[model samples]
Target: MPRFISKSLKKVGSSPGTLIHVGEIKTEQSSLSMLHFDAETHIEQPLTDIGEATSLLTPDATTWINVVGIQDIALIEDIGRHYHIHPLTLEDILNTTQRPKVESFDDYLFIVIKMLEHDKEKDSIVSEQLSLVLGKTVLISFQEDEGDVFNPVRERIRKGKGRIRSAGCDYLAYALIDAIVDNYFVILENVGQRLEAVEEAIDSDLDADILEKIHTIRRELIYLRKQVWPIREIITYLQKDGAPLIGEATGPFLRDVYDHTIQVIDTIESLRDMLSGMQDLYLSIISNRMNEVMKVLTIIATIFIPLSFIAGIYGMNFNHMPELTWRWGYPAVWLLIIGIVAMMIVFFRRKKWI
Candidate 1:
């Protein structure tokens, strides 16, 4: 779980220093960076001073300021001041647990999305809130941590590989969102592979560990859905909203991003079904195992039932018991017991319940 810190929104002429934290706080500190690029040149730097970076915002070139951490209230205030961001917007930024949303203002657009990264070492998905403020000439991004999911986007911009450099802030925003969505594919693929492996293990035998693995994967998928579902709503809002901030040229591209979101949703639904099936399968396999155990116990019980009866009859010290005086009677009774056991074994074999 992550704790969203409270932000004081004094400058927006609303409540002064109101205490509100909207999101989960899984980590204590966040990282920050910036990427400024245009059609010709691109620059990336780790920003320490908000004022200096704010001064660097230019109308002629596109700027992307990436904030990895939002724990410091002062830093958030400084950034808000630099961009003339609304108090409510700043509050939302600090409140990292916001649902995915897109808000259009007179001068810019604010967007919140979840960035999901799967840690192979931990075998878990690390979800962090990614906030984007798309202005006319700059696109500022706030993240919960410093992760390399955007490396491909950075490289694409660096090499001028696509329409990224030529596009405006809206397109840049789309590119970043699209990149994150693409990473979801990677995550799904990994999960799918692990699921296949689990299926194989389950088919081989119902091991205790397999259930744990199935449950772990299922839990991760549930978390992934929590991170991804809201993003779809956010993108859909951006697409349908009649906002000047989102360019007309970016509509088709945003649609592409929406499709990816849908794909993610579909994959999640499928995984959920698979998880349910796996649980049922585990139950059935366990039941089958218990049945086998019970079958063996029942066979042993059946063989002993008659033997116990015969022994009880012989043990009864009665004057009318003539077999006690006959020496061959004991051997005959032993043979009878052996024959009963053999017949029961053959009957069990015929029923294929042995």
Candidate 2:
């Protein structure tokens, strides 16, 4: 089955705000981590129990709660209850197939986006749903798996490298989003390299495998576009809607992320166009090859037509046939056939048909 289609049959009859997990269980066990940081202080620790989330929340500092897995329904519900996150929002968090979007609530901003990575070994893109709940002093991030592209953001927060340490939870959220967007460029670069390789293969060798490669890349781009296109709107909403959870200072950064989204979308479109053109070029090349073969066969059959007719006329059983009694009949017929073939070859060459 195509990876783009999510199996949601389990949710067909379920009520809204149901916490049923809809996608693959990428992680075996769910884990939680809390990072509390301010300008001069930074504290990071893993939480063994959900009850510890309340004790770890520092009212004076910004808290980032990272949930590594979402398969645990009770854990998600506990977090939601503690943070006062909407049940619908929690449902979106558990359902990995949620579209990239941002919802503004009275207490928090619910944002869902796909974190994409290019798997080098598989030569394909792997996606995981990342849901962020940005509140006044705390930001909760829920992921389908443990690994993510947010390591650089974590490094910056830990090292106090930039204004992030001095910023609010909104800015921290922006930093995380920025990291995800920036990694998109890396993924695109990898895709561009793949496209270059495919193009070179198309030009140098018309292997049947090249078509499959083009289709694979094309499908990946389409899936990427679906995952990314809505992000533009999400950023636009964050920047322009002036959500209470999104600070005014973070607007420009969201705009920057919006620009990156545009670039990603444009690159996706350009690559898709290239794939379409390559597909057409491949089919045309195959058609021309087939035409060449048919032309050769047609010419051969044309050359043999007269020879077959001549031989057939002399092949009659009539004893009075003049050619059968002639001494040079077979040789004369051979010469005539050769002359006709040569003439046809010259004619075809003049017409540029061979």
Candidate 3:
């Protein structure tokens, strides 16, 4: 589960206070990769030391320093020192569970987004926190792990395709956000398919396994919706809050990302509604099975009512009963009881109540 840290934790590098590890502690070390690029040329390098990354952050060309892991607090602090990032911002970066948000400062703009990817074999969704820092001619990103959904953007930058290379750092930020949002669609598709499979199985007999699968899908969707809803507000704030770091040219792109977020929210809401309906349907099916069981038991008791009455009458020892004295009377009474039971069975069959 992802913990939403309080804004008070935003205090920059303040005493390493109470490091609340929200999710998992990855085994990988925090590594830095620098991609310094311009319209005509590009350069990418892996940094062994944080100081080596600072010399590459020049105003002459746009730089994208991608941080792969974030467990090393010292490295993060050093990078913060180099860029003059606020302590609170550093805290947010170290805490990968932070919500999607955008903040503008005198020197740079900070944006946090959650990246979603679905693992088919595991049948689970993986979430990664991607934090982007935009300067005049550079963009820095920190990821919880290596290999993100930004490979497409990297390809675009490498191949010099489209306007990505021609644009500034803000445009790169838009591209990164857009890529993350697009991957949400992929995840939603998988979830929708799983829901559909569960629904089809539900149509026959309400299998316990099927219902459990449905429940699992519902839980995942709930988690996804929780993660995405606030992102809508984050994008809206970026578009309307008039952040200085977001360029006028990049505003429309960010607005486009806002639209994508809205689409994601709409899809999530639909999934939730579907899951609710599935729950109700499962309940009805289980109830119907229970009613059928009760009906069968009641019909068996009904069929035995007259038979029991016949047995009770013969069971009485009455001196005035002349039939009890007759030799064939006992056999005749047994035949009569059998005949009555046979008649009841036929009647139940005719009524379709058995």
Candidate 4:
């Protein structure tokens, strides 16, 4: 079963605003990490409780609180209560099957997007839902598990690279989203490589599993398209909705991310078209191979028809079969058989059918 469909089935009868964890339990326990930074100073620490998040927020410094696991409903509730997040937003955060979207609230903006990574060992794409809440001086990021593609963003924050250190929480939110969108390129690059391999296999060597490979890539593209297509609208909303949490300085950067999203979507569509073409090409190759085999079998059958007829006539124990009783009949029949076969071979060669 596809992960998207299977995870959504668990929420069939759920009421509105119900806090229920809907996806895979990626971590044993949810963990919190805070990065509070300004233009010159930075403080990074792990909190033992959600209550600590309030104390870490400062007027001068932008705080980024990262929750590594979302399976703990109580923890999510605590964070929601502390942050004044809406129950519907909290429900969306808990329900990992939520689509990529953005909701604007009075104090904060709720953004949900899928963070995708290529799992090399499994040779497949792994998706985790990421929910971001952007407030005045703080931004809280919720993830499904520990590992993420935000290490580069973290390193930038740690080293105080670019304008991120001097910027507001909106800029930080943009940075994190830009990181996710950038990682899409990396994942798409991996998918592109897989598509190339499949194409090469289809052209050079038609393995039995080539169709399965094409299908696997098609499914991955479908999954990726599902996750990525809505992000254009999400980014567009963030740019145009005039959410107070999103600053004017972040507009250009958001536009940049929007362009990148468009690029990613285009790449996905191109890969999908390539997969469809590859599928048709695979079918054509298989059909041509079958036709070749059938043609050879038909030719062989055609060649043997006369020989079988002669042998059938000779095998009949008719009282006076002239050819069967003649002394030279056996060798003559053998010569005739060979001559007919040679003539058929020459004819086939002249017709370019062999």
Candidate 5:
């Protein structure tokens, strides 16, 4: 079985809110970029230093600071210094295995969620932890790697194609969250396709290998559920908790996200049930094939029984066998045996047992 929670042994002896990297090392170095925009003006800048990024982050306009990698402990500490981000929230951000959740701080909202995609090369699900910090006029995002499921959102914000430009930081946060949620649908669709392929394979080839595939799909669904199930509560808190960090305009959008989360939960459950049924069906196919073999063997054995009996009597060394001494006895016995076999075959055919 694959490990569900990534090993975080680096955090074994650390303090409760220590900023130790706890996931895979995906990149060589971290990169920071900022997109500051509002109704009429927009600024795009690549940041090399946290101080510069902090200086640019003001309430004058909506800003989005995207940190591509979080393995550098120093960088996380620097951001914490400027934002007054709680140590615990930073801890969760570094721990990629943390479950999806939302929390409100003094001046910001901390959101942790999973970004998942199916890797065709690995034939498995790949997951990453995405942490979002929503403030009054700024939204900071932390990712494990550069480029993400947010490219479409970036395109929208750049073209001013939607309300994202005229919206506050909260709406920008909503757009990001919506993009992530929409990705779930894509991943689930891929899973559904794989299920269909496996289901077809089960019908044509019932073997141990198919059993292994079933187990694999089951594991994938289990992990997906772990990531998605918590999202319901995460969004529920935003929609109902009345968090000041989440704008009133964003409430309806978060509610829509919550509804989508429920749909994802339902899809995961239905797929799980389908996989269970598939396992049972595999067992049934194997059992039925075994029964077929046994039935054929029994029929062949039954047909030879009378022939063996006749041969045994004739081969006995006693002279009291009348049929053995008769001139036509040999041919007569042959005829009788052949007649018996013919009759038995007809009987079996009529009974549909042949």
Candidate 6:
């Protein structure tokens, strides 16, 4: 399926802020996981109800609610009502087509970003919508599917390898966003490797499959561009506009992430140029090969032109023709045709057109 087809198709006539799930709908209920932790204590639980999850959000704890599936309309609505999130924000969360953006609300800061990863099995880029609501002491995340690119951040939080253990909810938000951005680097690396393989294949010859691969990579780059470009704006807003939900100490890290995004954008642009050049290179290769074939055929026809005329002249039966009566006439005509073909071959070889 096309990656972005997760955008709800059933909302053609539905009103705005209607609690209708737009993406894939599953029969199985959505899974909710909770991580409540502070500097001195940590608690992880699997909650079957949003109410259970809400009760655990004490004032001293920093909680991360990861809703594995966003297809449950009632579930999302209940949670939104409990947390005092805006209806429009819930609408965006359900829509799943929301671009990478940051919007300030009365209670929390809402962030919607595309989580991109290279699908090695499919050899394509796959994207999932990740919605984050950053409040004073809690960060709620929503995703379309159960799998995500947040495992590294979860691992870091569990290991306490960094200042994440000591920071507030803002830092946790930063950590999550940072993890997503870091995966961009990995995605780009995979794309770079694919581009390299396509380029190397072009050196030997051109084929329909190679051309298709070029177009596929071009499409991937375009998709990556669409996802990457808007994220720069999101990061810029978070860094320059200084959303209150973000910490003062986290500003530097946000700036660093902004720089990383800038670098990623720069790399994406570079790869785009390279992919464009590869397209031109593919065309040039095909054109040169075509010209080579035409050159060879033209040479063969040029060599045959005089030989055809000579044969045609002697082929007509006429009593007035003198060569027809000679004993060596057939052998002479054969030698003359062979000699002309040899001379043409030599001339073509010397001209470097063979």
lDDT tens per residue, model 3, 69-163: 78778888788888888877887787776777888888888888888888777898877888888888878898888778888988888888988
**CA RMSD per model (angstroms):** 3.8, 1.4, 3.3, 1.7, 2.1, 2.1
Instruction: For each candidate, give its TM-score against the true structure.
Output: 0.89, 0.96, 0.89, 0.95, 0.92, 0.93
Q: After superposition, how far is residue 194 of candidate 6 from its true place, in Å?
A: 1.3
Q: Which candidate is the best by TM-score?
A: 2
Q: Model 5, which residues run further than 4 Å from truth?
A: 203-208
> How far is 50's C-alpha from truth in model 6 (Å)?
1.6
Task: Name the weakest run of 10 consecutive residues (lDDT summed) in model 1.
Answer: 1-10
lDDT of 1 by residue, 118-206 (tens): 78799777778888898998888877665647888888988999889878788888988998899999899889988888888888866
- Name the best candidate (by lDDT): 4
How do the residues 7-50 of candidate 2 rate in per-residue lDDT, one tens digit apiece? 78889988898889989999999999988899998999999876
TM-score of the candidate numbered 5? 0.92
**Candidate models: Cα lDDT each:** 0.81, 0.88, 0.80, 0.90, 0.86, 0.84
Clashing pairs in 1: 1-26, 2-24, 2-25, 2-26, 3-24, 3-25, 23-97, 30-69, 31-68, 32-68
Which rank order by lDDT, best down to worst? 4, 2, 5, 6, 1, 3
Candidate 5's C-alpha lDDT?
Answer: 0.86
Pairs that collide, model 5: none
TM-score ranking, high to low? 2, 4, 6, 5, 1, 3
Error of 1 at 91 (Å): 1.5
**Model 6 C-alpha lDDT per residue in residues 148-210, reported as the tens digit of each score:** 777887877787767887798989988888888889999999989988988888886555798
lDDT of 3: 0.80
